[model samples]
Target: MQATLTVSELLKRKNFEHCEVVAGKEGLERRIKWIHIVEVPKVEHLLKGEELILSTGVGWKENEEAFSSLLQQLITRNVAGLCIEIGSYTKSIPSSIINLANKHKFPLILFHQEVPFVEITQDVHTFMINAHYEILARLETYSRELQELLLATHDLSDLLSHFHQYLQETVVLRLKESTTHIFPPFQQNNSKQWSIIHKSIIDDTYTESKKISKKIQVLGKEYGELYVVVKNRRFTEENMLALDRTALAISQHFLRNLYIEEKKKRCENEWLREWIRGEVSLPNIFHKLGKIDGLHNYEGGGVFLCRKQEGVMWEGASFSYAKLLLTTLFEQCGFLLCITEYRQNILFVFVNKRQKQTWRDRFTQSLERFKKSEAYEKHAKLFSFISVGSFVDRLDEMEKSYKTAQITADICSEQVSSSETLFFHDDLHIYRILSLISDQRALHEVIFEYLNPILQYDKTYNGKLFDTLKTYLACSGSKKETAEHLFVVRQTLYHRLAKLEQLLGEDFMEPRKRMALEFMILAYEQIFIKKKEEKFPQCSEIEG
Candidate 1:
């Protein structure tokens, strides 16, 4: 250990035999703060506490009673000791002064022989200053070691263990409700039980305790706290400062983890998007799946998608609320491997198959529970559609499943009703096929070709031909049923039919010809007409 002079040690120095302790023998081990030589009578102002005062008897020369009072003042001012030379102005030690020193246990040293106060001050002060510097140097060394740990260590637990080694005390890091202990490894055999108790202790610990504590706040965000539990003396300022530096190191570690996780999430999200778009081939997808830990282990699974209703205002608070609710709902299904992403108004959930028998039931129950939950109630007005793709056995088919789920979600979004919002791609195969046809411009033109002439004739003549033709086909060629449905007399319908026959051809209503016209009419209504009506101005139809 580094050396420093104490009161007892200073007394043992050579040429210090002239110095005899008159009182306060119990305080012999008090560390000497500094050596001061003062001849002034009133020296309280000139002395900082903990100093060893060296003086001649000039202050106590005239009155011995006044010297007794000086001893009390020195004790009150909390000095180390008063060392007086006896050969100077006053010869003998005063009895009253010695009695006062003994009463207060204040150290009063008597120098029988002439002593050089200046030389003693020089040696003692030099030693004291050097000791102070030693402490600072040790603290600096600790700080550098901790900084090196921050640079070299990748794991928080490792850094925490090092902090334990340095502090030589139980260090606990409380983050949110999680507690990390330093003395015992975090994964100790008894760690679980200890963690419960230790966490409670940390929570219940006195907030104002003298124990070292520093909140692990960095980059304007407060992560948690770093604190030491020492049963011995209160932490010195050096200890507290050490804890502060360690807290900063922990903060940097946390920030590094956050940045790495964010980058990983972005890369994973982009890869998933590419897979959903079917840009990744089967071979490449299988290769990627091999790299995933549990891809081949899944038994059965599908894609899950959810979104806020279109036109529902996307506010920050509501978006966060929706994201959290959806995440919680899917994450509770333990065996289902899932990765989620939120973009625009949609939350995409990609789930891997699981061997559990109740997986389907659990997923269904979770959905029902979410619907009735407070989270759902808070944003129910913004509820849109929930779509699940067809489950496939192999992992390679997940990309197709995601695409199917997305398509169903889009279709369900447009047809809002009081009906169930959940859609399954397996039940909508026909609609999926219709989606393909709906995307083709040429299909729109070919399907609507037969109706174009009739539409033009009605537009030019203000006739009800188009309406009559629709009702006629809907009635399955029953003229009376068509007239009844259109609220028109049979004679008027026949006249409209004659007009339609004249415009196109008499064979337009023949069996094979009628079948072709009927298919065209259905395709036009399902694909083209509905789209045009939505965009163009409405025209009068036959009254029904």
Candidate 2:
């Protein structure tokens, strides 16, 4: 609180009982900073603002116009009040001067009993100084209490509870766009009251309950708000400062705790990567996992490799969103795990505690619900390719499971007509083996060898022989159907087939050779075509 003495309070002091308010009764609440005694006609130089001017009518005995002008001057200077001692120099104040005081709401006091000015100033100044000291002492005690609380506990709820007790007022701490945590958590009966206050805070309005709120911000980010509800209570300037300091303490605590959480997440990410990479030995993997919170238990779970749909329009926020979404789903779906982002995919290593089928169904439902959620509506076209690895009880076998999951996800990405997004590693074992073989240069060479001559001929002659061969294979070696599909005459189709037989051997259409050609064409379309499109342009010629 700021130190001050109101006009009414000043008049209630000892030896000032004879003072009477002549005009401007409405200004009784006006605070008096100092007292001034002026007797001269020109009193501007002797007066300061918020001073109670004391005088004996000396220079203006019968000049009401000059008295009114003096009153107007005092009003302009923002003088607290005017106290005139009567019967010595002047008998009474004029009605015109009283009317001027009334109009301005300036306090006009009359000392009916001629008091000693020196004694009055001494008494009032001493009282004001003593009151100011008391306020400072109270402020110091309150501040020290808050500082001790800050040192005693890191829990924000406990700090807020103590603050409420100290102030004897309700204290609410709200993280912006988050739930409100109250000191004495709102009672069932107080729901309406809480709703009103919440609306007021969100709408940037005020309620009947006097409140002093400050934004809890640090490093240019506003974390939340700290507001004290001063219902039926008086809050002072000192209390406002106390609230500010307390909010600052909470902000620092949140920031410090946030750093620890980030460090923990980074460590978890690294450990999981190393586990999947087989860098950690079977015996040491569990020990390393013990270093991370909530992951110290025995190993028995499956791995999930999640990849977003190709060409999905999403920003970096999608990564965090996916992590948060999956983490929430895992926890609620009863398969607790840690999530890590590798490249563009998010991996989750679930700690197997229940039936695998049940967990799978739960995870699928959670993902479906997430896709339909408002939070994910902006990414409406976004879908995920999640592949689950086989359950393994041993830490050493986890890496093998993780590899299977990764391969399965890649196979799923290449699928064009799969109705389901979630794939099991066991169900796609053939494709997994095929994907491995598809990565070999020898296999690509064999596939490209059979198709390269036809490609070159088509490019050189601008002919449709490759299309004719593809269509003939697609029709399962029916020449009439191939001719009808190619919109060519039967004789022309026979002539093209003879030319093909001349280029390739007569045994090229054998079952084994045809099977190899079909496999080669599928490999060429899936592997080589995609690579050609993605490869950077070679510097074969200099640019102008």
TM-score of each: 0.42, 0.44
lDDT by residue (tens digit), candidate 2, 180-234: 8776676768878777667645655565666779888743357789988766555
Off by over 4 Å in 1: 2-5, 62-69, 90-96, 167-180, 184-210, 220-241, 261-544
Query: Each prediction's Cα RMSD?
Result: 18.0, 16.1
Candidate 1 lDDT over residue span 402-486, tens digit each: 8777777765555335577777787775466666677675565555466677877877998988788878877888998999999
Stretches > 4 Å off in candidate 2? 33-51, 57-80, 87-90, 182-186, 195-209, 231-235, 262-544
**Candidate 2 at 18: error in angstroms?**
0.6
Question: Lowest summed lDDT over 10 consecutive residues: which window, candidate 2?
Answer: 535-544
* Best of the candidates, lDDT: 2
